[model samples]
Target: MPMLDAIKRHLWSIALFGIASNVLVLAPTIYLLQVYDRVLPSRSLETLSMLMMFMGIALSMMLAVDLVRHRLLSDLGRQLADRLDRLALAARIDTHARRLSRPELATAQDVAALRAFLSGSGVTAFLDMPWLVVYLGLMFLFHWSLGLIAIVSALLLVGLTLLNDRLTENSVRAYTTRQRETDQMAAQISRNAEIVTVLGMNAAMIDAWSARRCVDLDAQVKAGETSSLNRSIGKALRQVIQAVMMGAGAWLVINQFATGGVMLATTILLGKALAPVEQMLGSWKQFTEVRQAWTRLDALYRSSPERRAVELPRPTGRLTVEALAFSSYSATGPRGRMLLKGIQFVLNPGQLLVIVGASASGKSTLLRLLAGLWEPQAGTVRLDGADIAQWPREALGRFLGYVPQDVELFAGTVAANIARDPNPAAADTGAIVRAAQRAYVHETILGLPNGYETEIGESGETLSGGQRQAIALARALYGDPRLVLLDEPNANLDADGERLLNSALLQLKRDCVTVVVVTHRQSVLSIADRVMLMRNGQVDCFGTREQVEAWVKSRARPAAAPQSGEQRREAAAS
Candidate 1:
């Protein structure tokens, strides 16, 4: 919409340029007429020189005007990219975090495609197309028969173009859809290349990708073949129509119904009239892509409308979750099987709560909800007595820290990864160093080739798992956050790394930073102020660490042999 609005602002000026350019283009036709009809008959060199001089000036002006139009369109495209790039990226991240968008919907690519369309000649073709009538009118002015021929030519070309579109539309859509799927599959395979390689399925993966690629390619070729054939037809038809117009003009001249000048002028006028149509037909594929891109982006933006938020005063580390419930998608509806249910809890400033659970017991889900990365299907998660949703995400993020089960870094310097992930150039070096020290990873970072400036590849693939985890901890600890959420923080840690992590947690506790962690480590459990055990989407047991440990031990022990009825009755009476 913004792009359209920008174009609308410049629409009149662009139209004016098109008008001037088309009128100036008429100079050549006018010159031929003047030379053949006036200069030759009068045998005057003065009139011919004057006409050529005016033609030269008009041609120069036309070039300048067209250049300005092109520049305006190019700048408009750049502005579109500048304005929508961040919004598309933010919407994408928000959608992924909230599980609101289909994975195949790539907003960034759509924006890029739209930009390409605006900057290229696709839009200009449509802009120049409206001037076709002026040229046709001039043809009519020459003679009625010439006008009839030009009209017929235009209609035939327009009809052919529409027919081409009708025949290829379905195949083009199929090709686009199949291409997206193929690209998604390729990205997935690349993301898991290590697993595929280790399993010796490289050939199989290649085969799978090639098969999908071929499907898309086949669809593309199917559409392209029709388009190519139709283009050839259109070109041949134009050529035939041009020859017919010339023959008719000569016949009219022989009969003394039209002059030599009129005959030559009509041909030039017909070309000007049909030029826009030909341009549009030649670039029809790009026009379709542009339309598709705009449609997708429009839909994406409409679905993810921006919201206004009021900044609230910051609060100390206190959290409350009430009647929380979450579910995974199913064949029936959005909320089907509950992953977590009735998960209520509270934490005061400086408190530490550890959650322990078996696989798929909703420990990770609970952590995600607490971190505000997900919305619960029922009830709410409140931080410092206010619903987390009430706070602007960036504002809320400042006071909270999170490290997921699978830690990830970025493709940037170590300093950038540790000191707030975005626009890291503004991140303070001293603060980065301090956070690293707090996480006990300062020495580790220093050992790198560039120390804090070391370039770590995507997801920190250049580093070992333990090193990645250690740096992620440093990132979470960077902002002096009031609440820290970590899941399996020590999963990949060496003994020293584990010791350093424990030390970091203790330091955070000492600093009155409320903490919630999900882990299976006994060492981590030993230091918790309280513990909660989750089982099958419900709280199995929750209490102080010692109490929970006792309950767990009791549950693990075998039950006493069933008592006889009389012994049970006697014990009850006692």
Candidate 2:
């Protein structure tokens, strides 16, 4: 609706063009009348030649106006697409961050569909629909009975169109929902193709995928069948109307209320009046699809959160977390169990803090909160004395680097992956190589056939898991980020990879970059200035490395000591 106001000028121009084109549509009927009533009776070649010249000029003007109308619509559609594409993508990304299910935000495909409808024949039909009255009035000029019949036929076709819409709306909606779910499932299967193939899950996966496909297909078939039936009936009725109009015209002419030329011209005018309605009936499905797409896009745009208008300066490495808490939605709905509660920590610039915890101990949740991937329900995360939400996202991203537990690379060249730049040409080659060197992946990259220019398959499928993690580490270290968060960075690393990771962390520390790493391996703890141990979503210990290690040893001593005299006697016998 607001979008309509934006393109009002374009719509007005199209309306003017429609009026001119429909007026010229009367040229053929006029030509027939002149030929039958004037030229033949008088045997005047001059009159025929003059009429032909005027008709030619009128039709040419009509053609020129129609072309301009189409061009305007196309330009309008392009402008709309350009404006909506970025907003749609942003909304989709925001929805993902909020952990919301909004399949309509998955892509800008809906924008494209709306654009196509705007520029295609569907719009032209809509613009011409209003001119149907003009043709009907022309029919009335010839006789009253013909006008009555034309009005009745038009109403019948309009009723049929309304019926079609009512019958197919629900099925179309269901089909759209099912199709999006199936597409998502298919993408998931493709991403995990290696696991499926190695585990011999091809049959089970295929069966599951096919089940969704079948449901989607069933909905589509139901909608299609209803639309097709209506279209066929509309076509048959349109033919009948044309024939009946001609017969009625002949009756009027025979009764001396009209001329033969009047009868013929009126019948042709009737068809012209109903042509747009017939075309709309046949294109009801496309019209419905475009309407749904527009509705979804509008809803998405309206629901998207307003972004910060003011940009702030980049942050320094000093980090703070105060009573942070967060929860996620469960399968049932909102208000699920909490994942992190009262999480408190602080790390100054140039500090190296290592977090050690068992599996499912809230380590990853803490890292995500620190990295701003998930917002805390309570408390504030601050950097450089400013709340994380206060700083502009782009500025914050430049100062922060995060390597998640599951390392995956996008489809691009090795250099591009390391740079994390969408535009490869704009990527800084020097910085990329420096980051790779720091991550100790430079030599391994050079050993490849094309080195930095080598193409990495989707998610780096062509390379080993260690190779992917190394490049991802390089990405995190790119541009000498002021703050780095690594979650289990050495999960897939070999001995050499582990050494490179530690060396990278050491170099980062020397550069005054604050770092937080989550690891179970004690080897990585050698570089830690402080240690935080977590248990059951709470911090068990937080202090200097020496203090935490001594506590750990003391706790182990009790469990290692003899628990009973029987155990002591067995040991003495041995």
Candidate 3:
């Protein structure tokens, strides 16, 4: 509805153009009638000349109407595409964040399909189908038999269209599903190409990918064959009907029921009447695709409805979470157990808190909730005593900085990534440099091929793990955010990178910015003002750094003195 809302204003104008077009369409039939009935008997050159001029003028006007109508539809398609671009992207993000079943599987390609459908001949043909009545009415004026023949022909074609749908509907659905699967597989291979080659999975993956592609191709072939066969039959059927009408017309002429010119004109009228039906049959496949795309787009827009946010002043990083609860969605529905429950905590400005937990102990989940990425089933996450959701989504980056466990960068210059610029050309160069310096990655960046202007490949695949994490740290610290949420910031960092990260955390405290870190490294605990040890989604201990350390020692957990990040993670999980 949102996308169609963009183009609703043009619909009436299109309808007016359609009326003009249909009226002008009578020129050819009337021309033939005049030449045969009036000019041939009178043998008048002047009359013929005037008729020819009139015919040309009528056709010219029709062409002009068609051109304007085409431009209107084209503009509508572009408007729909522009409106859907933002909605699809936001829906994608929300869908992934909510961890819900993606039955709709909406994507940008759906927008392209909708645009193409609106601009393509299929829509014009569809619009023309309704005007078949105009041709039917003209044929009836010529003779009752001619109108009867036209009605039967139209009925047959409509029946074929329905039959086409029934025979190929399943095949079309299969083709759509397989096509999405194939695309997803290709993306997976591209993303994991490094590991696939390193592990000698090229041959196996190629066979698997080929097999999936073949399934898609087979479904496509089945649907296409059915559609093409129906189209061929429909075409043949139209020819037969035209021949029958012609025979009837000649018989009527012989019986003095119609003039020779009238007989010829009935043939032309019948063909004109059937044109839209034939076209609709030919474009049945496209119609199906467009219908599916529209359905998916509609569902996506509904899932993520637009909301108005009430403006509030900048938060001072007073974070609070009381009696929070969250659960994962299983295939059937929400899981029976909560992932995070009874999560109660408060961190004021200038305070630094570190959270340590096992793989599934909900540390990362809690961080996501605190960052307002995920909503809790119960209780609320508040900043400055107001609900986090009160601030508009566009203003989130200014309120908090988040560094997830997986550090993947977009494809752009280093400075653009640091500044988080949606448009790289207008990035804040000075702020970018300061953030990079604060994260202690400026020196490393300078050593790159183009310094801050280097083009990092997709997901920063060109960089090493430690270098990627270092740049991610800079990105998280880019703007003057009031709070920072970090999940395993030092997981992939080297010794120098870890030292720089510690310095950055210390700097945040000096600036009175509340910071919460989830890590498996002992180095962070040394600088932590407070610590929380999570066990089975519950806070097992919460106190000063020494208190949590003593609790870990009493439990005989190896978390107090971690030798390696991986070992610490394994120990905490155990």
Candidate 4:
């Protein structure tokens, strides 16, 4: 349905071209009739020459019209792809944020499939299908018997097409699903090649991948077998139909109901009428694929939220979280595990808040909420007295910087990675240099073979873990964002990296930027003006450094050793 909506404007042009092309097709049959019935009996050179000229002119016009038609379809395909690409990408991002099943790859592949079908011969066959009726009507005028044969042949081919669709539908759907899963698995394995190799787990990974591939392969083979069978049957049926049309025409001529030229022309017309059907049958697989692609893409577009129509002002550095809660679900039921519960906190401009907690204590979840990467189930994260969700995503991104525990860098030059630039050539060189300098990795980058131009392998594999973390930190610091959230920012940093990180934080504090750091390291805690201790999805303690430290000590102190009887008596006397 969406596909039709996209190309409706161009449909009229395609239809006109089909009409002109089919009309010109009549020139050949007419020429054959004239040659057999009139020219031969009259022996008129003028008539033959004139007919030849007309035939040539008609065919040349047909060629030109058909060419234009194909070009229009190709343009339509381009238009569809351009319109859907951004929408599809945005939908994928939204789905990921919601922690839903990812269908990005499948969506992209579906768009490509539809585009290919639109620009291929399959579309041309579809456009010409309407001409079958015109051809059949002309055949009926030749003789009743010939017309009857043509009608029956068309009906049989149509029946075969419907049968093929019925037989292959389920298999095709299964094959497509399995193929997407296999592709995702292969990609995961490729990205983790180093780990698999070092752990000697290649065999195991391959076996796992092969299991999925085998299921995909089985579905493909079954679908292919059925499709091939239909193709074979369709081909045999066409040949038989052509033979019967010829034999029937001969019979009509023997009965003096039709002339030899009429017989020949009727047979040719019958073939022309069946051509579209045969072509469609041959390309049924592609047709089915396109249909499936359209359905999926339509659903994706429908599910995505519309973009913000109005812009909001930029946010200041004050950050607040009120009663934030989050949970996830599964098929059986809700996971019944709350990652964050009743989270309430506030940090003013130019202040630092450090959150300390053991693993699975909801520390990272709070940071993610503050960054607006995940939405709260029952509360709001506000910046400068306005809900973060109220601001446009792009506008919010300008003032928000976040670094997760796991750092990933794109495949590009060091400068591009540091700048977070989607287009490297257009990136701000000065901004990149400043960020790199602030992170204290500028000199290290210069020491490399190509200063800022060195290419980092995928996910920055070419660099050490510390180098990646430093660059990622520099990326977060880019533009001097108003609010910065870091999860274990010093996790991989060595002594020098840690020193640079501290310097950066102090500078941010001086610049009046709000910062939230989640760490277990005491060195990081020492700089915090305020600290919160998280345990079991709730804040256990929240106060200034001294107050929180005192509480932590009180909690950590073991109960005094059981007093001996003499010690207890001395204490009571005192």
Q: Write the per-residue lDDT of candidate 4 for residues 154-233, one digit (tens) a residue.
A: 99999998899899888898788778878878988998899899999999999999998988899888888898899899
Off by over 4 Å in 1: 1-3, 99-104, 301-308, 329-333, 422-425, 553-560, 563-574
Candidate 3 lDDT by residue in tens digits, 370-409: 8888777788999999888777777877768888887879
Ranking by lDDT: 3, 2, 1, 4
The TM-score measured for candidate 2 stands at: 0.91
Query: What clash pairs does model 1 have?
Result: none
Please provide, for model 1 over 1-574, each residue's C-alpha lDDT reduced to its tens digit, 9 standing for 90 to 100.
Answer: 4445545777777778778877788889999998999999999999988998998998899899889988887887787777678777777677657656464454666778778877777778788887778888888888999999999999999998898888887788778877877887898899898999999999999999999899889988888888888888888988898899999999999999999999988987888788778877777766776676676666554554446677777769999999999997532346658899999989998889999989999999999899888877898999899998787788888889899887878888889899876567888778889989988999999999999988889889889999898899889988778889999999998788888888888888899899999998878876789899999989999889989979989989998899999999999999
Task: Determine which window of 10 residues in candidate 1 has minimal summed lDDT.
Answer: 298-307
What TM-score does each of the candidates earn?
0.93, 0.91, 0.94, 0.93
Clashing pairs in 2: none
Please report how far candidate 1 places residue 395 from its true position, in Å: 1.8
**Candidate 4 local Cα displacement, residue 503, angstroms:** 1.3
